[model samples]
Target: MSALPRPAHGPGSRYTARAATTRPRPARDGDVAALARRLTGRDLWLARMLHEHRVLTTHQIARLAYTSARSAQRRLRTLHEHAVLDSFRPLTASGSAPEHYTLGPVGAALLAAHAGLDPTALGWRPTTTGRIAYSPSLGHDLGVNELLTHLAARTHTASGSGLALWLSERSAARRWGDIIRPDAYAHWRDGDPLLPFFLEYDTGSQPPARVEAKLTGYAAFIAATGSRPALLLHTRTASRDQTLRRRLAAAARELDLQVATSSADFTTTDPWGPWWAPLEPTAHRTTLTGLAAHWPHLSPAAGLEPTDADTPLTLPVPPLPPDLGSGS
Candidate 1:
């Protein structure tokens, strides 16, 4: 028999070019103002999100902001047409990668204007989209965003369980880069007693020792700030997870750092469920919320108090968008 051809996933198949649309022209001050007036609150919120997190996939944007995938596509296409967002479809080994959206020049300008600053202050260049599209850390960045976006999307439910605070790598670095540089930081709340954690999304690209060294940084961060947010190391495979769990257990013990680990193999629709295994001899796994009960000594992270140099623009973006009464 002849070899079979692989199936294309959707209209966004890597073989097909994205549907052509009217590209936005160079944005002037008046143009930005006009675009700003045309944008809704949800649009502005998404702009702020992209500015902070760098990029989001079409599916992620849909989950975060829309009632349905079709609605998200329509709104995102319009945003791209207005130059509030720019998208790229990566060539994958198989199937298709969803359109990944980044903050466009006009969107950057809009954010700057809202903050009462020049566009230069935003440090956004015309090359921003291209840079992120080709960056080596693209997968790592996306993995981090994926985990958090799942938590952020929980707000649409009536459970009152969702991300209370989410700081991107850049935002977390700005706060505590000197001591530690977490991949991301977040406060996940199911109800009372929110679980604050620092995510370290591992792709299994680095050696186990290098991964273990990260614990030292967390130890330093705790000592310096007196904050003890749990360190979450999520890896690609079960073997890698086991290897890390064995390698880092003693280090975590010596450093007295609150550490937990999970692998993609164990993940499901509820990432907040009992997928997390603390660095101990026990085989028990716990949900993100259950971690609090596991360790009674756990406390929320500190150092979020604004410094003299901080401005309203420099503050962390809220985890969820403003409720615009549009079911977004």
Candidate 2:
């Protein structure tokens, strides 16, 4: 008999290998039901987050959920072992990539059962982890999550400032795809002022004009909904940020939109710091909280209420997981 071809493994493989620590097990309905009994509220919250955001690295997950990296890693590995979360580490030219997590079959089943739906209704296929591992927009997705994770992590601090609402691209699309498609939608709370904004994490892959054209959609959204949330354009480079500011200035003014621009160079550590520059001719940058004061006319985006068409499973995932102190 002819020899069978060996399956590819490791870096650059078409089918990226799952973490070696992951023990493959069949996740039948009964098996998943048994696994569900062992899952914590945080675990279930993590599953919902993965389902919404598509993927998250270990660092991001730790920042969002755990007080320590070791704890997050240990718990995440346990989740992977029971097939409650799937993970794959990508090949990197430098050091190894952190394990990226997605919703596992068991996790999906748990969520579906909680929502009183069939497992197939969750839209998670067996190839989900592999697809996210090799996705071209992986970096872009990670960058978006990193910014929001930082915002959410603020809740762990003694400071009373943190993200109040965060809607992933999928959730945002479901809510407002008819008018505009923001990369993410967020309501940030720092003290009494709440800064509601639509985030556009630009990677500079598209032309400046192309980026500016998105403003037209926002204009329509505002006109249709009567909500004037600030538009935050986050670019990969200062140069691209400058390009977008200049390119979109006239259109933004003409549409009477509240817009702010920031670059990755300026927002590495503290995104809520004085990194945002309004579209107007101002050299002074302002904090995210300050933006609310700068543009007092801006209103919170509407349509966040659960609609008649929405199932419990389809609701927006909470920005932060349930409090551990509450026995979650």
Candidate 3:
């Protein structure tokens, strides 16, 4: 007997021309049970998270949801078959890379339906979602998401702090694309002051001139937005961080912009430790909670400061449950 046909649109599916370029139709099953059979509340939540964050990896999703890797893999495969999520594997040097996933057209439609909003208004275009998995910057996009996910997980594990809000690159682009588009924007609540900052993740592949030019654009962004979010540069190596600092100084001299540099070379013990050094004169390595003191130009975190019960940088609230995934 012939084997049953596998799902036809995920990482393992055959790439037909129609599948490659078309938008997914909304699932039309009228029976609620049939619909529920297709997806769970947790599945819908995952879809919303993907919509908000733009992209994530299988490992990241497993962490976000309560399931084991095997379960996440099975669920994601089924969802992809129904076009609820689209995924792709980036070009890697050695073994296969973890599959990266983005919101698919059908998932977006479902979310839009629940909210009583048009999918377009919700930033869900069939063509757009269908095409995102194939983007050349998929790896960079995934890396940025990983950064936020890590912070969210870290906040739970740490003593007294957590993420207040996170804006994905697309959200940043919507507001600041005219001047500069940050990789990510986050509101970090520590003890004394709430901190709002723009994240720039550099792989050390872009030319120094190109990276430095962002400072000029950022100067314009600050003037345009009337918001002074500290610029944090995370580079691949210590040398790259040093070179980037020099470039930032030159750019600062030409245009008024403040930035912080950090090398992503730390061991796991303190992966998010005080590796950040402001571009200002007499800058020193400082933790994320300490950046506010170094970069005075940053605006007072708008209405997100922790209460008297919780001290900044110290744990006030109990750690989050492992399954809910930080809920940031």
Q: List runs of model 3 lying over 4 Å from the truth.
A: 1-41, 67-82, 90-93, 120-130, 253-256, 267-271, 300-328
Q: Write the per-residue lDDT of candidate 2 for residues 22-74, one digit (tens) a residue.
A: 45555565787688887888999999999999999999998888878888888
Candidate 1, pairs of clashing residues: none
lDDT by residue for model 3 (173-197), tens: 6555777888877767665666678
Return the top candidate by TM-score. Answer: 2
Per-residue lDDT tens digits for candidate 1, residues 73-141, read 888888887788877767778887898898887888889889888889888987677667666688889
TM-score of 1: 0.91
Instruction: Give candidate 3's error at residue 112 in angstroms.
Output: 1.5
Q: TM-score per candidate, in order?
A: 0.91, 0.92, 0.73
Quote the lDDT for 137 in model 2.
Answer: 83
TM-score: model 2 vs. ground truth:
0.92
How would you order the candidates by lDDT, starting with the best?
2, 1, 3
Q: Go through the candidates in order and give the clash count of each.
A: 0, 0, 5
